[model samples]
Target: MHIRDPIHGAIEITPGERRLIDSRAMQRLRHIKQLGFAELAFPGATHSRYAHALGAMAVATRVFDAALREAPLAPAERGRMRQAVRVAVLFHDLGHPPLSHTTELALPPLGALALPEWLVDDPGRQASHEDMTLKLILDSELASVLERSLSDCALTATDLASLLTGRTPPSGAPFVAGGVDYGPVLRQIVSSELDADRMDYLLRDSLFTGVNYGKFDLDWIVQNLCHVVREESAWLALQRRAIFAFEDFLLSRYHMFMSVYFHRTSIGYEAMLRRWFEESSDAYRLPADPQAYLGCDDVELWSALRGSASEWARRIVERRAYKVVYEEHPKDPHQAPAVESALRAAGLPVIVRRSKGEVSKYFGARRGIFVRTERDVVPVESYTPLFERYAEAAVLVRIYVPPEVREEARTVVARVLS
Candidate 1:
């Protein structure tokens, strides 16, 4: 099947890829916005994970093709690796809730719907879209396609898990920690720092959000991804791959964060969504449990909000839609309470949420991005300097209050600025 994507242009897929894309679960992405509530601000930021995933898989295919030319894979191994990569791209967004990451912080009546309950609370516990992704695929249409098209059962349940999480399988191959070994060449293509996922999203997001900062030289980046064989200690390592577009990818991510993801008003709108769901009774019909939230996508969430047994959901989703009342930077953390006090006194219901490391007191509480490095993929913090910079940067704190309190917020901001 061929798709003419607005961001990546023409997208081609095999029959198996088409089946996976057409799956009921994968189709759920249409309602799950890539930048949830972002369109409320940008108007054009309504792209969905479905599009991004297609673009990502396309990039993966191109990268794998190029890398194989450099060091071709055996026929058997190449087929397995391709299937794994396709599965990985298809299921990457399976766990994301309706609004994508916009609803990431809101606790479902049952923790996260994506991973098992253990992974949500225990950050160290092996929690990933990859793990959940594999589970979805092995149990879904992707599994059927793998059996039908390739006729190779190499993509075992465990192999799917390993591909998504970047873990090396046991016994058969002495897979080094954090290094992928799906043959030498294809692994390099799919798992590198400057891999398909980043390449697709940067350009795709730029087009969707109407932001130009993420645009870069794509063909150049792909062409430059050559093998970097290095000898360390006694052994010669064949797995070293150049981070051809890594810096560009990192910089593009940073720009996307600043320009689109973290826009203050966008943050405020997301905060409103969070408040409506958490404080409103209508959004939560079930007890706080993972099973309740599991498989509940955007449509269900919105449906619950509109017809929730709780009064809060009815009011926000039904009547007001919860408008933003106040927004401003915290010149001094000490004054946050004062701002909160003034807004409350003025008759608006107020809630404040901060980014990690924004306050010295919450130092160790912040979760940094984890990367699968040559050494480790556990904490993305250790491998990349870019993520560390993001962690330390002062995150924006959004305060959401009832619209009736808008006058009070304006009064408080005027006083603070004066």
Candidate 2:
């Protein structure tokens, strides 16, 4: 099957992948918006998770092929690893609920969700969409479909699930049937800092939102990829010449987060959605079971919004969102509290939101990306000053208030700032 994606052009799916895409769980992604409530701000940003999944798969294939060119593996093992990478990236976002991460904040704590043993290791961590995706792949009908589709390659649902999590499989693990282990290189193709997931989403989100901030030299980066084995561990590395392209990619991500993902309007609506969900969670509880949770989507939320009596839901439905009274890039972190106090003292209802602007934390760690130098492989940050400068910068601190009180709130905030 060939899908004409706006971001990746024509994406050709293999017979196995076509079958997996046709499954009920895959089809469900068609209704889930990739950017959650961002459409409220950017109407063109209504693309679905289904499209993003296909794009991720396409990019993963490109990176996998590039890595295989330098990887040492038998022909049969190469074919198996290729199929595993494809399957892992294709279904990585299958478990995302309706509205994506917007509603994820309202999901019950990890303890409340009846997650499988493999996913329960981090009890203190909350149950996220990734956790949900892992559960569906292992415990739902999607698991059976994956197992059957990749049976010839000796790949099981567990194998694909493990790859999606980007973790190394244990020696003699149950998932490693026939003693075949694709190793960390295959997992990195889908989940690493510069993996297919980030590559596709940056371009895809930029295209749908009509923004050029997320654009980067994807072809240059992909073409320059090489696999390196150092000290018995494998990693995906890029040619030293592509350092500029790699730096551009990181800068593009940071710009997109500032201009699109964390746009004041998008943040306001997301906060509103969280408020609505919290107020209505009792009447509309998120399912603890993976299968039941699969049934929940944007449609369910729309239904509740249309029929609900909650003020928060009604406000969203009517587009009566809170207004931003004051926004600034704080020079001193300690001033935020004083600003909030001044606003309250002036008789204004205020909610102060601070956003950290460190884009490198997601992409600049020691294990994140590597440059294949003539002498040896080195971490990208070791030779790049851009990474260190913007590694952890505070971006915005905005105070929100009801629309009716916005004018008064602004005056109070101005006084605090002065």
Candidate 3:
């Protein structure tokens, strides 16, 4: 299938991917916003997960080609690596809840329940999507297509193993399999600090949000990639690691958090969505999951907010969101009290308090995976004055002004920030 994406022109996906994209599960990604409430602030930032996935796959393919050129792999291995890279990128966030991560964190219990029933009760489970993805690939018709794409019958087994372990197919294996890690060489392309996923998203998000800060010289950086032996393993390295390219990527993420993703006005919009979701199952009484109200792509969690019988969803859909009553940037990274105080002062409802510590937990909050070596702890801030300038910055506070007092509340916000 030829998908003409605004960001990446023509993205040619295989028939198997086309079928997967057409599935109700994958199609739901169309309704899920790539930037969540970001479109409320940057009107153009309404791209969906469908687009991000396709774009990421395209980028991954390019990175795969680069890896092959730098250190050639067997034709059979390269074909399998392509399947693994494409599948991994395509389904990376298939389990993201409605409103993406925002609602995922906000509606934990419902979010918890909304996950496939199979995953909800299992303590031994990985991510719901990861499990479902493997299940779908192995049991569904996708299995044969993916195998055919790789020309290997055991691709699914190898792919599953790779995601489970960060290692790729053994050199003795006839082919590599798709997962977060396929082969060490392919893993470097998909992961690594400077990989295709970030490269694509930075540009893709910037383009969708009307920001230029996220773009780097992707062509130049890709060209500079070279293979180097690090600790007896071959790894891809960039000539300069394109410090400027990386600086742009990091700065873009930072600014997007400030100006786009966390815009105070949008916070008000999301709070409205949160309230709507809260009333989803209670006798406050709703007929449907709000997830139905959004476009087809955004379907990980039912947008119970959009389907709420409550006045909240109606108000928000009608653009009657809250205003920002107060704003603050905490000076210390660990200042929980400051966040609590600001929320109290604004008189906004509490949802979740995400500490840096909480944010650090990944792969379903089991524990963080760290790669330890003799190298110095990455002083990310030390590398660039830009990062150093914001090192002490901890938290950003936004007090959502209920729709009723927006104008008056705007004044309060100005004074509080001042």
In the order shown, what is each candidate's alpha-carbon RMSD? 6.6, 2.5, 6.7
TM-score of each: 0.73, 0.93, 0.70
For 1-418, candidate 1 gives per-residue lDDT tens digits of: 6899775678887786677677666777777888776786688877888888888888877766554444444666666666777666666776566677756555332223344332244544433343345445555545565556444535554455555554455534322222434333334344444567777777877887788878877776565443332221011012223232454556676667666777755666666666666666444332223233345566776776666665455554544444444444435555556677777776667767664322122124333222233663343334445445554555555666666656667777668655
Among these predicted structures, which one has the highest lDDT?
2
The segments of candidate 1 whose C-alpha lies over 4 angstroms from its true place after superposition are 103-131, 140-145, 169-193, 229-246, 280-295, 309-337, 345-347, 355-391
Off by over 4 Å in 2: 111-116, 168-182, 280-283, 330-335, 362-366
Candidate 3 lDDT tens digits, 179-235: 222355555565555556677777888898888767667776666555544333444
Q: CA lDDT, every prediction? A: 0.57, 0.79, 0.55
The whole-model C-alpha lDDT of candidate 1 against the native structure comes to 0.57
Q: Which ten residues in a row have the lowest lDDT in candidate 3?
A: 354-363
Highest TM-score, which number?
A: 2
lDDT of 3 at 42: 84
Give the candidate order by descending TM-score: 2, 1, 3
